[model samples]
Target: MTPRIGLILFTALLMQCENPVKTPLPGAETIPAQIRQTDCFNGGNALFHAARITEMGNRASGTPGYRRQIDYLKEELAKYGWTCREQGFEKETPQGPVRFVNLRARFGKTPNFLDPVRGLLTCHIDTKQGIDGFTGANDGASGAAAILETARILSGEPARAGNLELVFFDGEESFAEHMDSDDGLYGSRHYASAMQQPLPKWMINLDMVGRQGKKIRIPSMTPQ
Candidate 1:
C-alpha cells in the first residue's frame, strides 16, 4: 500500500476516541461554562472561509493561485495572534525539481522560548495538478478552512494554543496522474525529515473533510 493510504488508516484508528465528535476541547474544565456554551466551533464561519478560498481558483504548487492562498492564510492567521513562518524546500518530481512552501504557525506574535508542542494539526493547501479549473473546494480548501477555524477557536485558549502547531502543506497532489513515493507528499516529507527532537505527541491531518452529509464513525473500543 502507498504511504498516504497507510497514514490514513493510522489516523482513522487514532480518531476512534469515545464520543469523538462530542468530546470536550482539551482543558475544557478550566474554561468558564458560559464561554464553553457560547464560544465554540463555528461551522458557518468555516464554510465561509472554505468558499472564499475556493473562489481563489486553482492552487496548484508553484502557481499564482497557490501564492494567493498562502497570502490569505497568513493574513487571517495574523488576526488571531498567531505567528506564521514558511518552510520552503525543493524536491525532484517526475517532471522536474519544484519548490514547495509549507506554512507553519504558532501562538503568540513572538514567542521567546522554544516550547515543545504536544499536538499538530495539518492539511494540504495545494490543489491537484492537471485538472483544468479544479478549485479543490472539498479536497484542499475545506481542510484549510477547518484549520483556520480551529486556529480562531484556539486563540482564546493560550495554554492550548501554546501546546499545538498548525501546518498548511503544499505539493500534496502529484504532478502525474498517479502518486508514487517520489512524485507526491513533497511538503509533508520535507517537514518530516526536517523535524527536530521532541516531536509532537499526536497529529491530525485533515483532507476532503468539507463534503456534505459525510458521516464519521468511531470504533466501539475507543478510549474515553
Candidate 2:
C-alpha cells in the first residue's frame, strides 16, 4: 500500500510538470523609480518579516490570534494612508459558531475604478492550528509576510500614486483540516461576491505557503 501511494504521488508530480503554461504579461507597470535602481533580485522582503511577528500561534477560523493578525494588518495599512475596514462574517464549525474578520484596505483616488487602481496585492494573515508538537511557521507566516513587506515597499515610493488595494482575508483554512467546497475560502468568496464593479485586472491569492522556491502555477484560463 505504501509503494502504491508513492507511485501515485510520483505520477501526480509528473503530470503537473508535463506542461507549463505560457508566461502571461508580467505586471508592475507602475513600479517606482527607486525600485528600478535596486540591483538585488528581491523586489520586497523587508516588510513581510514584520507581519510574521503577530501570530503567537494558530490563527484558525475563530481565535484571538486571528483577531490580532487582522489588527496588525490594519495598523500597517493605516500607516500607509490606506483606508481600512473589517467585514465580519460567521464561521460555523462542529464546535460552534465563530465570527471571522476580513481586513481590506484600498489606496488610490478612485477605488471603484482601474484607472486609479494599478494593481492588487493580497494574502491571508491567519495561522493554522497545530495538533500536538506542530505549529505552522511557513504555511501561515510566509504569504502574510510577503504581502506586508510588499505593502511597505510599494507605499514607500515617492512617486507611488497608482491605484492599489491590499486585502488580508480570513477563514481561508478548512475546518476539516483540508480545504474543500464545504470548508474553506470563505473570505475570498464573500469579497468577490460583494464586488459591484469589474474586479481588478490582477489579483494574487496566496495559500499553502509552506513550500519554498515555489513557481506560481497559473490556470490555463489565466491571462498570459
Candidate 3:
C-alpha cells in the first residue's frame, strides 16, 4: 500500500482528537485541507452510500435487509473492477446456527485463507439486532459507506506496490442487546483465525462514522 495516500485518506476520514470532525489535531494541520482538494475521500460520496444503506431498513444479521446490504456492496464494488466474493459460514446463535457472510473486495487475486496483503480496510455491515427502527446510520452504515467511497477513490489510482483489500463484515454486532464473549465480532474472529504469516501490517476498522460534527477518539492502544 502507498502509506502516504492510505494514511492521508484514513487520517482525513477517521482522525479525531479533542476537536470535532472539522477541527484538526495538532501537527496534522494540512490534512483536512489536502483532503478537500482530493477526488478521493469525498464526504458526499460516503453520505450517499450511508443514506442508501440506511434505506434498506434495519440490517440485523440474518434478515433480508442484511442480504440486500450484501448485494448492494457487491454490486457497487464490481463497478470499480475489484474482485468480490462472499465468505459464508454458519455459526451457532441463541436461536440456532445462523449463516453469515463477509464481503471482500480486492485489487489482486481472490482472497485465500492466508493471503498476504499490505493493508486491509474493514467495517461491519450488520446492525445491532432486536432494536425497533434501528437504522444504524452512524454505527453500521457509516463505516461501510466510507469503505465504499474509499474503494472508488483507490480504484482510479495506479496500482500499489502491494495488494489492497476492503472487507465488509456481516456480524460485528451481537444478537443480544449487550455483547457476550461468545456473541460478538464473529466476522473478525473468523478472519483472524484464517490469517497467515505476513498479515496485513496496516488495518483500519471504522464504526460510528455518520454522526455529524462528532469528535474522533483515538484509542490509547493505537500505535503512535
For each candidate in the order shown, give its overall lDDT on alpha carbons. Answer: 0.78, 0.56, 0.74
Model 2: CA > 4 A from native: 1-51, 108-118, 157-162, 208-212, 215-221
Residue pairs clashing, model 2? 24-224, 47-149, 48-145, 48-149, 59-127, 116-163, 117-163, 118-163
Candidate 1: lDDT of 130? 82
Clashing pairs in 3: 16-216
Higher-scoring candidate on lDDT, 2 or 3: 3
TM per candidate: 0.80, 0.66, 0.81
As for candidate 1, its clashing pairs are none
Highest lDDT: give the candidate number.
1
State the lDDT of candidate 1 residue by residue for 1-224, as single tens digits: 23343344434433323433444455412212221222556556667788788888989999899999999999989988999989999888888988899999999989643467777789999999888878998999989987887788778899878878899999999999999877899999888998877877667788898765445454454433
Q: Name the candidate that leads on TM-score.
A: 3
Model 1: weakest 10-residue lDDT segment is 28-37
lDDT of 2 by residue, 54-151 (tens): 33566776777677777766776666556676788886754467677887777643344323344455677665555653335556566666565555
Candidate ordering by lDDT (highest first): 1, 3, 2
Quote the positional error of residue 134 for candidate 1 in Å. 0.8
Evaluate residue 61 in candidate 1 and report its C-alpha lDDT on the 0 to 100 scale.
93
Order of quality (TM-score)? 3, 1, 2
